[model samples]
Target: MQSKIEKHVMLTKKLALSAVIALSLSACGSGGSDDAPSAPRVQNITYEALPAMLTFNEGETVRLSLNTKGEGASGLKFNWTVKYLNQDVTFTGQGSDTISFKAPNVDMHSTMQVSVKLDEANSTKTFGFHDQHLSLSIKDLNPPTTPAHELGEEVSEIDTSVLTTGSTWTETHKQNSRIDQVDSSYNLVDSTLIRSFIVESADQNKQVVGTNYCGFPDLNSMELNASVLSIKCSSGTSSTQYFQKENSFSIVQKCDETIVGVSTFEKKSNEAIASFGSLNMQFKNFADLQTKEVCAVVATSKVTAHSADNQEVAKEEATAIRLVTQQEGNDFELHFAFNEAPNGFFVSLNSFFDENNKATIISGSYPELNASSQSGSLDLDAKNSISNMKGTFNFVLKNDAGLNEAVEGDFELVLE
Candidate 1:
């Protein structure tokens, strides 16, 4: 009987211990709930009227709408304010959730701070008031008044009919000049040079006469059309030049002055070359002692020529041709040859000249016969006190075997 009584006492103690643990857990789970209702969670608070970030021009209106996701938001009140240009301005919105105002004008780029306050304690069960802020960029909208001329706009084609033989045109102006020295690796060393000059041209035989500062060899011939006036000039080879009628009819001489015509030549010519093939070449040289540091190789050639019958004699897909030049002490030599000679009739022009002198074609034959003759001129222009140089080439290929070809072109290369 005593053993049974002890067993009953142990069971009673275990039951009391379990009951104490259960009470402790219940108190921990509802520590503050027994006194008052728990605070409601606030979430998804955001603006619906304006974007997170805003951009506007001065005098533009901006609108804002406030939104929230949770219970007890009906009694919330919103107070709006804007801080602009070091001053703060408060706004009254009649207890509405939306705010609207005009952006203030600013002299330059500026920013404004817009903020809203929500009275959550008075209107909802949330812990306290909520604050939201946004940044707005206000930009000046006035247009810029610089850049007097519109670039890349097509102008009217020049009327070349009135440009009769012996007719002369002249102009003078200022322009920005750029000089670039490139190394063999195509790295460029550049400088800006100020240049000025006077230019005059006559229609007869297309002779161009001007001061040494603006000298261009006399044009061998000129062709006029409804939209373009193409001029062919020879210095060492043949140079076929074109001017768009509708563009800036201003003639640029020695890459210096840009001349505008005081009087317009309104006559148009019916005869014009249909097409001229393209020429491509490149020049590579080193600008300094740096290895692999090379100047931009000038490898560009384009020519549009028509036969006497006005038929296109040159096609875009013809065999490639190039003009290469090398410096030999105080003299320079230029070679013109086909990348792939059409036949044994390969024609080449080897011209050499010194500084401040015209290039003379020394040797080259078309038919490889004694009667074959070749002649051409290369006129070098030292621009910006020898900062750079440009040369014009005009060559005539004549063979006793009935082959005759005239080539004219120009190239610009760095002096250094």
Candidate 2:
């Protein structure tokens, strides 16, 4: 009986202790402070997110997000806007933690502003003490490229990509009265040059002479492409170029390193520098007078002259003929430019080969010979010194002032 009574008292003590502990736990769970604890609120937000870089291209899609501080993101409202210039742009998502949108087209997008505002679900969406905001700037993938000022027309890929197949680029720069050499600061800088590229192999790309870059530099270090060609220089003064036509394509380069020639030149336009081709044409001269700046070591031709009415004017005699050649893109041309011939005449016979190996003179000049017809057979003999000989030639020629004449001839000539 005494044991049963002791057990009942112990049980009563245990129950009393349990009640006290339960009351303490209840007070802790219910915020039992002198004043009611403040309700949770969104104090701020984290505007940072993954894919760290925010830069994007036109029509690119991207997502931005916001994280709340004083409150859970689910209970918070977000409003996002993109201000482009003076107008607000429409985006895909609002009233959410994240939003996505497409970039505007390149022509339309420049710099843009993106902003977001945060509000509680219980309050109207507007700027408030609890609300926070952030702004971001978006940029374009490609901006306007710097202009290639002195290189003539803007370069195209077809013009530069031709480099990989092995190309020749020549450059000649003249500043102040000097030719083929200059510095960054000068009175005036002019361009005139030529370069020959020989593709020995994939590993042996170099200039034809193996060491110089006429006007266009031999590419080195960087891979060859349409946009950039790097020069190989031991002096560390080399430049990078962008190629685009002619003897050398369009380029931004400085050529003074090493080049040699005076073959075919006009001083301006630099149009006639391609002094290399298969033109062994001998001059049909009317006088033995010393000629002016003709591109020839020596030349003489047996010829006849005529007037517009199909009448022979003079007998064949050695005069002076100047053979000048120029490379126009892919066309090779020979121009017989004469300052003066027998009877105070100014003329030119411009000739090129047709597909059938016939030399045809296409067009001539005003007060100058523009021979537009040809009927001929010509031969070049090395041992005999006969450059263009044993051919019966007929030509119908005209000047810009409409001086038309037809002259046919058989001549013996030597080009040395």
* Candidate that would win on TM-score: 2
Q: Which stretches of candidate 1 lie over 4 Å from their true place?
A: 1-50, 68-71, 90-95, 120-124, 127-130, 147-416
Residue-pair clashes, model 2: 21
Worst 10 residues of 2 by lDDT: 19-28
What Cα-based lDDT does every candidate model obtain? 0.33, 0.33
Per-residue lDDT of 125-212 in model 1, one digit per residue for the tens? 3333335567776765652222224322223333334344432332222222111111101111111121111222334233333221
Q: Distance from true position, residue 92, model 2, in Å?
A: 2.5
lDDT of candidate 2 over 1-416, digit per residue (tens): 12221221121111011111100000012334668774444333333332312455667786775543333436566666765433566787788767787766532113345655544443443223233333332443453333444343444322322333333333222211111111111111111222222322232242212222222234532233321323332111233344333433333322222111111111112233223223333324211112222222222223333232224444322222223332222222222222222222222333343212223332222223344433333322233221222223344554466645554443232222
Cα misplacement distance, residue 203 of candidate 2 (Å): 23
Clashes of each: 50, 21
Candidate 2: regions farther than 4 A off? 1-38, 41-53, 67-71, 120-241, 244-246, 249-416
Model 2, position 8: C-alpha lDDT score: 18
